[model samples]
Target: MTLTTALALGQTALKLGLICSLTVLALFLSYSMLNVCDLSTDGCFTLGAAVGAAVAICGHPFLSIFAAMLAGACSGFVTAFLQTKLGVESLLAGIIVNTGLYSINIAVMGGSSLLNMNKTTTVFSMMKEALSSTPFAAQTELIIGLIAVICVVAFLVFFLKTRLGLAIRATGNNADMVKSSSINPVFTTIVGLCIANSFTALSGCLLAQSQKSVDINIGQGMVTIALASLLIGGTVMGRGGILKRAVGMVLGAVIFRLVYTIALRFNMPAFMLKLVSSIIVVLAISGPYLKSQWPQIRRRLTHKKGGI
Candidate 1:
């Protein structure tokens, strides 16, 4: 590729990676910290896009962000309620919420599958206009995404160190123990999921605005993508401080997006992208275990060679 082409590709990947990193961060909170595999992520993401787009189309660009987050928190609350109060299984609760959100998303989009913001003012456009006189005008999306990531990371770092955050973490580690310690596991679960899903919604909201369009299927397979990114981050950072791991999540997202962008550059069919994601997920999930077993496998191979 020419230098210009490479630069464009890198920029595309970085923008997308940063936006999607929010979802990865959400997964880091819900899946890793809470030990809850939330299957509702895809729907919740779409919910955010739909809600954000709807609000923005009504002439409230900035309000759209908060609206999307609030919508996602409601979705999370429903899922958490099912699991904690209704005695539903966490996975099943997520599945139910995801299934329901499809209809709700459609309603939010005025029963349409797509919403176009071609002429609507979005946060990106607002930023672009604000920076038009500066050299950063063309980098509005990047700047916004970077700011969002930094804010979320900082919030996570500080929040995880607070008392409630410690209780949430303990609940994830052992609910029974947390209950014994006088912490309400139910409350912690609800709060944790609400916060995590809000982040997921923010990611989707920014993505929709950046792309200037919202599609019903825009968030399809997002859970897989976020999980893959989270696993990649865990592998990269191993066990470390919250800030370290949080940074790893961003790095993982960028790396994953870079690989994805390269695959597209190779002229891979659009249909094959899902397979690429699946392959990457498998590799990320299994990499640590396979690395740990390498020595044993090598020893067995040497013994077999000697016997032969």
Candidate 2:
């Protein structure tokens, strides 16, 4: 590719990667920090998109962002209630909430599965207009995504260090110990999950505005993608502080989107794209394990050759 073509491709990947990285960071906070594997990510994400799109279409573009986040917080609250109060398993609670969010999302979209914002004023359009006269006008999406990611990473770095944050981390580490210390694990779990889901919803809101549309399946398979990205991030930045690990997650998301962009450039079929995502997930999950086993495998091969 020409230099210009390469630059454009990289920019597109960066834009998408930064946006999707929000979801990956949510996973970082929930799964890695809180030790809660939230499976309602897909529905929460879609719910955010649905709500954001509807609100933006109603001529309140900025309000849509907050509204979507509030919706996500509500979803997280429900999931946490099921797990903490109703004695439901975390995974099952997430699944139940996710299943219910489907109907709720539809209702938010006015009983439609698709929402077209072709003429609607979105946050992106507002940004585009504001940046129209600047030299950086063409980088509107990148700017917005970068700002959001930086804000989130900064928040996490600070949040993870506070007393409450430390307590939440401790709760994740040992609930019984936390209970003994008079820290309510249930409260921490609820707060952690609600915050994480809010980030997920923010991601969805940004993505919908950027695309100028919302589809019910916009968040399909998002959990798998985020999980894979988180694993990749952990591998890349193993044993780091909050800021370092957060940056790794963003890099992982960028790398994932880069691969996806390349796949599409190769004229791969749309159906096969899902397979590609699966393959990426598998590799991301297993790559470190295989690396760890390579030496033993090589030693066995050498022994067999020597015996022969």
Candidate 3:
């Protein structure tokens, strides 16, 4: 490929990675820290995109962001309520919410499966317009994405250090222990899920705006991607402080997107992309276990060689 082609591809991947990294960060908080396997992520992401798109189409660009987040918060609240109040398992609760969100998302999009915003004034467009005369005009999307990621990461670092945040983490670690300490595990779980889902929604919202379109399937399999990215980040970062781990998540997202972009460049069939994501997830999840077993495998191989 020519240098310009490579640069364009890289820029596209970077922009996508930054935006999608928000979902990875959400998974970092929900799955990694809070120990909740929120399966509702896919639906919540679509919900965000739909809500954000609709609001922006109505000429409320900035309001779309908060509206999307609010919709996500509602989704989170329902999921938490099912798990905590209705005695539903966390995983089952997420599934239930996700299943129900399909209709809701479609309804939000005025019963349509797709919404085009080619002419809508999205937050990205607003930023682009504001930066039209500046050197960063062409870099508007990247700038917004970077700022959002940095803000989210910084917030996570600082938030995780606060008393409530510690409570949430402790709840994730041990609900019984937290209960004995007079902390409300239920409350913490609710708050954690709420915040995590909000991030997921923000990710979807940003992605939709960046793409200038929203489709019902836009968030399909998003949970899988985010989980893979989160696990990859955990593996790469191993054990680290919140800040380091958060940065690892961002890096993992970028790496995954880069790999995906390269795969597309190779003219890989679109149908196989899902398999690629699945393989990446399996590798990311199993890599550590395989490493730990390698020494044992080596010893076995040596014993067989000696016998032979």
Candidate 4:
């Protein structure tokens, strides 16, 4: 590819990577730290996009962000309630909430599956206008994405170190231990999920604005993407401080998007994209385990060869 073409592709990947990394960060908190596989992520993400777009379309661009987050928190609260208060299993609770969110997302979009923001004054448009005269004008989306990711990462680093954060982490590690220490696991789970889902919603909201549209399927398969990204980040960074690991998550997201962009460049059919995601997820999840088993496999092979 020509340098300009490559640059364009890289920019596209970077823009999407930064935005979607927010979801990965959410998963970092929910799955890695809180040890909950929140399947409602896909729906909560769509809920955010729908709410944010609806609010922005009504002339409250900035308010849309908070509105989306609040909606996401409520979704998280419900999922948490089901698991904690209603005696639902975590996976089942997430699934039930996710299924319910489909109708709610449609309602949020006024019964439409699509919402056009072409004429809307979204945050991205606002930022673009503000930087119109500057050399950085073309980088408006990048700037906003970087700002959001940085803010979330900073919040996570600081929040995960607080007493409540410690308790949440403890609950993830061992709920019984946390309960024995008088810390309520239920409360921690709720708090962790609320925060995590808010991040997911923020991700969807930003992506919607950045694209100037919101589609009902905008968040489909997001959980898989986030999980794969999280696994990739963990494998890359192994064990580290929160900040380091968080940065690794961002890097993993960028890497994943870059690969995805490359696939698109190869003229891969749009229908095959999901398969690519699934394959990437499988590789990310199994890569470390396979690596760990290589030595034993080689030893077994050598022993068999000697006997032969």
Which number leads on TM-score?
Answer: 4
Q: How well is each residue in 195-298 modelled by candidate 3, as lDDT tens digits?
A: 99999999999999999999999999899888777877777787889999999999888888888898899998766756877888888778878999998999
Better of 2 and 4 by TM-score: 4
lDDT of 1 by residue, 1-308 (tens): 89999999999889999999999999989998999999999999999999999999999999999999999999999999999999999999999999999999999999999999999999999999999999999889999999999999999999999999998899999877987798999999999999999999999999999999999999999999888878877887889899999999998898888888988899987677667778878987688789999989999999989942
Which 10 consecutive residues of model 3 have the lowest summed lDDT?
Answer: 269-278
Model 2, position 17: C-alpha lDDT score: 92
Top of the candidates by lDDT? 4
How does model 4 score by TM-score?
Answer: 0.95
Question: Candidate 1's error at 55, in angstroms?
Answer: 0.3
Clash count, one per candidate: 0, 0, 0, 0
Better by lDDT, candidate 4 or 1: 4
Looking at model 4, which ten-residue stretch has the lowest summed lDDT? 268-277
- Please identify model 2 stretches exceeding 4 Å from their true place: 287-308
Worst 10 residues of 1 by lDDT: 268-277
RMSD of 2: 2.3
Report the backbone clash tally of model 1. 0
What TM-score does candidate 1 get on C-alpha atoms? Answer: 0.94
Tens digits of lDDT, candidate 2, 1-308? 68888888899999999999999999998888889999999999998899999999999999999999999989988999899999999999999999999999999999998999989998889999999999988999999999999999999899999988898889888877898897888899999999999999999999998998899999988888888778878887888788999999999888888877877778876566567667777987688789999999999999999952
- What C-alpha lDDT values do all the predictions have? 0.93, 0.90, 0.92, 0.93
TM-score of predicted model 3? 0.94
